[model samples]
Target: MVTTRQGVRLLGPGDVDAFLDLARRDPVANVFAMYRARTTRLEPRWLGGEAWGRFHDGELVAACHVGANLVPIESREEDARAFGERALARGRSVSTIVGPTEAVREFWRTVSDSWGRPRDLRWNQPHLVIDGPPTAAPDPGVRRTMRAELDELYPACVAMYTEEVGVSPEVGGRNDLYRTRVAQLVSRGWSFARFDAGRLVFKAEVACATDDAAQIQGVWVPPDRRGEGLAVAGMAAVVELVRAEIAPRVSLYVNEWNEPARRAYARVGFQETTTFSTIMF
Candidate 1:
């Protein structure tokens, strides 16, 4: 462990236990890091990124995973500053920085000049979490997307991606890569869907799964299915299933401007836990 006079330490695969202990201090807020730490074992070479830690008097206070997704786990201004300086020193290698709103914004303030302006800044993201059974009745038909349903499910995944991110996953000729991810979700039983008369009606994926929580993503109700009470029931079903089978709690973050989503989640009993921000580079 190389510790700097400033207390910033670059963590490697060997530091998994310490990284995890730091992440567990607030499980829900640190779900992403906890998930990656457990699943990836802090491996030096993991999905094209690395993890770094900030220590204070030999105690790990914060950590950042920099890669395709630059995520910070409950970092303070000082911790964010150190991580930001490290990122700036590396040039613009990260694709995004996402975490608690304050930490992300503070970190961005430090690296914006070196990183250039972001293509998109989702600043008002409400992080919501739900525990126990849902209040609304779950959609009985909701179930995991089967391997055979990949062909039918792929388009819905694409639609959700394009709608949520303002650009198709197919952009930059990455359609094949996008399809593979959807397939992987289905194959791992991480995807859920409801079909009416053999047509896909609603879909969601457990994007991050930790022992304490499962964060849902790519939730979608087709354009024609809007205002039909599908989202509430469908989401209820997802929450019930995920809570019972995957994790003890379910969580997700939605853009604050998405009123309909906020309403739908509230109907399913999800309460705001925190605010997360994302800087898409």
Candidate 2:
């Protein structure tokens, strides 16, 4: 258990192993992986409280962060206290707080009254856990097809993501931060989608995965063709590929308020395992 103060140095691959240990208790490994990957890629100035943890006796017991998320640690409540202090000292105002729902709630409870509350958004995202037996493989079936030729897909994916998040996905070269994960997925046998109409309108991506799980992200249908519910079939195609190529567990994030998106996901066999929140002000 490393002491809380020593963890002031928590960033980069230093905390990778410990973080993975904590994620083991989590249903989806990708949730943690995506953020970790972002940390490595952006090297975002360690912007103070960039990462925080509370460990006891040389083991990480609790952790949190400020980045793609404000992940408050709950496995150890004391760490959350330490993390909040560190974040405030840095004069930080993060874009969002994304983490285990309850952990996030507790974090907010501490500062909401003082720093003022950000917009509260709940997630109804569902995760597909691997069942007792392996599922059947896709024939033409399941596959994660990375596009070497479709340079056009990036903008389209950005559009889809913006629509999904209700904010524009970064259009400037700024979002290149995600390219590493994109490339990582491609290298690790991840799948992205292309429509038969010859447009790169639909795709599936994973933020993180391992032998036991392969969490997914970036599922989208183009705005021009959304009414057709193309996202469902497209996601199904991706799910089959995930089932075949990646780990058995395939998961995705859906905004809690987005009923149509939730319905589409449930129709494809996803079930809500828990709630999560992404606080953005």
Candidate 3:
């Protein structure tokens, strides 16, 4: 008979494989965590925070990525509660707590009082994914963004971020960091957009990826172009390019209150697989 040693501990580089194996249990849903794990390789210096794991029988079962964003991976209510306790003790260092709905809720319940009130609580974000070809016709004009077009794209990005997050990315003097992030995505050929007569119309970027999936972020259509089917066709084009080069599956999450955005994604053949929640500071 084998005895199980159950506890939560801070994971390190040596735990990378175990962490990844746990994440792959639901690749599309866990894409963000997996991407961070792969990129940072469980190094605290690179992670800028820490990764915590819950174990049973000396085997990893659930993990949490604690950084600027607190993301729980395959965590049950109990696991999330425990992670939340740890987070509370460490103090609220993250700007956001996001992940599967139940886990995020449980985690938040654990830390909410100590963490203080968040700027926003998004409790019903639909987590959507697409594997096969997009249903809508791809827009021929929608293509990878060129580095030279950064000047054109930067404004739209700022607009989108400010609208979605309720604050300018430049707040707290993060203008350079945010701009550099946009450029990095463009340099990696992950930014996509459609422009008309030198005016940017639609745009999005693959925020992160793993061998199995990629998560799209910053999806936006200029206010003037919102009802012109630009987003549907533009996203279709992005799906084609992303599937052809990045990962086989594409995923994204949208706020439940945004019915128009939700409908557009549905038309593009994305189906909601789960719900996610975010508590943003």
Give per-model CA RMSD.
1.1, 4.4, 2.4
Candidate 2's C-alpha runs over 4 A off are 1-16, 27-49, 73-78, 113-120, 123-148, 171-191, 227-229
What's the lDDT for all of these models? 0.89, 0.60, 0.93
Per residue, candidate 2 scores C-alpha lDDT tens digits across 1-281 of 23435354355556666665665667462355444534453244643335565666666676666665676644444455566666655654677777666666666666665666565466443434433232322224224555573365566666766766667656566577655545676666664776555566567777666666677777766667676756676666667766666667777666766777777776666767766666776
Taking all chains together, the TM-score of candidate 1 against the true structure is 0.97
lDDT string for model 3 (1-281, tens) is 22223378899889999999999999999998898899999999999999999988788989999999999999999999888878876899999999999999999989888989899999999999999999999999999999999999999999999999999999999999999999999999899999899889999999999889999999999887789999999999999999999999999999999999999999999999999999999
Candidate 3: clashing pairs of residues: none
Candidates 1 and 2 compared by lDDT, better number:
1
- Looking at candidate 2, the ten consecutive residues that score lowest on lDDT are 132-141
Candidate 1: clashing pairs of residues: none
